[model samples]
Target: MIKHDVSHFPTILVFNTTEKDKTSVALIKNGSVKISEKSRRAQELQSIVEELIDNNHIEIGEIKAVAVLEGPGSYTGIRIGATTGNTLHWLYRMPVIVIPGTDISEAAERLMSGEEFDVTTYFSPRD
Candidate 1:
């Protein structure tokens, strides 16, 4: 098996707003889940992220990449997650991963394995 250099992705922030009521956020570090939270509402996404990181004593600068689920679910939710991830990428110049499915752990693993994703700034989920 080939080994991948995932040193650059020490910490990854993940957003999964594909499910309307189950919107969630996670922080993956060294291929382990440091924190995971389900947002009570769509508007809570930002606060959820902040709370998770703050509680885990993780600083924003420690995050090397951002992963967001590019939905087959709620359009509004997809927009929220995608917009947040894209905005972070633009601000921090970090890689933004667009996941096409619901498996957050799988996506994180792919990143840890040095898999590349095509990230786009705009998102328009099917209604």
Candidate 2:
């Protein structure tokens, strides 16, 4: 469930932990990107989020949504990402958009549109 907030700057927190032992987070604020990814995803997820948020000067009220990569990939990675997104949803009462993880391109396209990609095969419905 997403609560509408007109008082704050709308920002999306996008994260993908679909690959094994690799995690990445992207905080999209005002067309600026604060992102980090490494093999240390598990150990660094929280810190990465903090760094992105702090560096971007995002307040709790500024977060409009959290978009996370839902998986056809690593179970642990998906679980961790889901957990973090859920935590954010609980804390902020913002909507959590679960993006299908078949390709990062779709999510990226949705986040910011300028350049375009050729369409590929459509994915199945989420299980």
Candidate 3:
């Protein structure tokens, strides 16, 4: 039995696959983003996680859930982030939540407007 003392605030791991040139993962604790980073390759993802853990002084076991960008972007980027999130979830028994990048943008728009707005997202491969 592993004992984890996750703070009562929400903790989220956000991944972005919106652009091939830019991939990012963010760690949010208590509604505050503690760490955010970008990497280009799958091999670099783990290192970013390690850096976040080290820099934020957080334990891997302390993460309560993972919030990953589900896609409509680079397939390989999504796979990399999803694989990493899933692995962590399996190892720590934490919850995994997925949010599309469009949804995030829509939410931001709604917050800014204080009114509901129709939102649509499209993705196309880069040639």
Please report the candidate that would top lDDT against the real structure.
1
RMSD of each: 4.4, 6.9, 9.0
lDDT of 1 by residue, 57-79 (tens): 98898998788887677778888
Candidate order (TM-score): 1, 2, 3
What pairs collide in candidate 1?
none
Mind giving the per-residue lDDT tens digits that candidate 2 earns over 1-127?
2222221324778778787777778777766566677677555688877877787776767878776787778777777777787777777776666676634445655566533222212212233
The positional error of residue 2 in candidate 2, measured at the CA in angstroms, is 12
User: How do the predictions measure up, each by TM-score?
Assistant: 0.80, 0.72, 0.67
lDDT of each: 0.73, 0.64, 0.56
Off by over 4 Å in 2: 1-9, 102-106, 114-127
How far in Å is the alpha carbon of 58 misplaced in model 2?
2.0
Worst 10 residues of 1 by lDDT: 118-127
lDDT of model 3 at position 61: 74
Please give the lDDT score at residue 110 for candidate 3.
26
Ranking by lDDT: 1, 2, 3
Tens-place lDDT per residue, model 3, 7-118, is: 3326655556555766566777664665354646545777777877788888887777665566677678777767776777777776555454634343222223323222
